[model samples]
Target: MSKVVLVTGASSGIGKAIATFLSEKGYKVYGTSRNPKNIEDFNFKLIALDVLNIETITTAIASIIKLEGKIDILVNNAGIGVTGPIEETPTDEMRNAFNTNFFGAIDVIKTVLPHMRKQKSGLIINTTSIAGYMGLPFRGIYSSSKGALELVTEAIRMEVKRYGIDLVNVAPGDFATDIISRRYHTPLFDDSVYKENYKANLDLMDAHVDTGKNPIEMAEKVYKIIHTKNPKIHYKVGGFLEKFSIVLKRILPDTWFEKLLMNHYKL
Candidate 1:
């Protein structure tokens, strides 16, 4: 029997790639997105889903369950990014980020866990980011949301271990996704306060994202993990820069790390 997999945020980027790749791998895959009309004749089924809407999530899961009978894998890949200084960011923006990045994942997980618990065998992969580990300037809001997701994944892993379920967190460093290209609704900052510094920081983030890894690379990593017999709790995917960042955080003192980041970003 083919393993059944459900992936969220399947319209594009890593999520879409994962859905396509997994379907090609012979898994009975179902991909969800807010706009499902664009997907047609794909290897997997595309269902309309808005992570922020609990009703939509519940209905989608119910529909999938009716046909598949069992879900073997669930990938929480739906998320958004918000950039700017923490002080400058608005409360609503912070809430929106957390709603989609953290709460949305939680909502789907809660809906799927019951079936997985009954079956006693399943895998849940949460798409976190390197931002979850290291907070970057100008992107603190997005980073904080991912950081919350990291902790949530950790807790879920522990809770679900005894149920014969595997929970994995895929933390990709700066992937080349349309996320950066999309216009962000950032908070308006006071022009008089650190105007030049803020503009420079935003520019640096834009340039960094423009040169990040391809989304397919991240999708391939997700494909590999799904098929592994013994998957680790966390997997990091990226180039040398990602590894270097992790090492720097590990070996360097807090003050030194801050200095390095400041110099790197020219903040």
Candidate 2:
């Protein structure tokens, strides 16, 4: 029997790429989009889901279980990007970002964990970002939310280890995705002192994503992760610069790393 795979936020980008690729490889793939209409011409099954809504997530999982009997894998890939300075970003705005990017993943994970635990075997892959590890100039909210997930992933690994379930954190660098279209920039930036520099820096961030790596490459990396008998705890997906930045951050002095990051964003 083919393994059942449920990929959230599969309407486009990395989520869509992973769903499409895995379905082609013979997994019984079910992809989620907030609106079924946006799923378009996809070979996999489409489920209506709003990751920020717990009830919708419950319904989606129930539907999948009703047909597939068991979920072999759950990919937590639904997230929104938020940008702006740390101080200028409203508290509510940051909470909203956490709701969608961090808590939403947790909601889905909590919903499906029982099924995986019952089966005594499963894989959980969380789609994090390079920004999750290092706080970017204007992407503080996005970074912190994903960074929260990064910490959760680490602890969840130990908790799920006894259940024969695996959890992985894949930090993707800038990928050519609709994330740019979907990103939310804080309105407060307009009235702040960092206006000029922030706008220029934000544009620079978008430019990198505009010419970023392909989503298919990320799908390929995920595919390998799914199939590995005992995959590593963490995987970084993106170019050499993206992956190496983490290492440099690890080994380089704090001031040096800050200088490099500031230079990259032209801050």
Candidate 3:
């Protein structure tokens, strides 16, 4: 029997890439979206699951278990991008970001843990971001949400080690995806002090995504992790410089690293 895999946020972008690849590779793949009913083009199974809604999360997982009898792998790939100055961004929106990106992933993991524990074997791969490694200018909230998930994976992986359940984080750099269109962007008020700098940074961010690596790179990375006997706690996928930036953060002083990022973003 093929392994059952659940991938959230699979309606497009990196999630879609991972789901489609896994399906083609012979895993029983169930991809999810906020409105799976309308997503008709996917090559694998698509299901309705809104990460923010616990009911949907439970319902979807139950449905998959009923059909497949077990969830061998879970790719927690659902998340949204949130960008704006710390002062200018609405606190409510920031809360929403955390609710979806951080709390939401935890809810899904919590829902799945019991079944995995019963089975005595399971793997969970979380889709985080390269930005999660640091506080990026104007993208602080997005960074924090993903960064929180990264740390949580580290802590929980050990907690559940006895259960034979494995959890790992896959942090991807900017990918050519429609996330910019889907993400929350705080409106720029004409009188706001951040308006000018925010606008410039927004363009820079967009351009990076517009020219980013193909999403398939992430899919490949996830596939490798799934098959590994003892996967590492963290894995990163991206261009040379993007992956190297994490190393730079480790070796360089705090001020030096801050200067490097500022220079990259032209801040």
Report every candidate's CA lDDT.
0.86, 0.90, 0.95
Among these predictions, the greatest TM-score belongs to 3
Better of 2 and 3 by lDDT: 3
For 1-267, candidate 3 gives per-residue lDDT tens digits of 999999999999999999999999999999999987655587899999999999999999999999989999999999999999999899999999999999999999999999999999999999999999999999999999999999999999999999999999999998999999899999988999988888999999999999999999999999999889999999999999999999999999999999999888877
Candidate 3: segments with Cα more than 4 A from true spot: none
Off by over 4 Å in 2: 38-40, 188-191
Ranking of all predicted structures according to lDDT, beginning with the best and ending with the worst: 3, 2, 1
Write down the worst ten-residue block by lDDT for model 2. 183-192
Span of 10 residues, lowest total lDDT, candidate 1:
183-192
User: Candidate 1 at 163: error in angstroms?
Assistant: 0.9
| RMSD (Å) of each candidate, 1 decimal | 1.6, 1.3, 0.9
Better of 1 and 3 by lDDT: 3
By TM-score rank, best first, the candidates go 3, 2, 1
Residue clash pairs of candidate 1:
none
lDDT of 3 at 65: 94
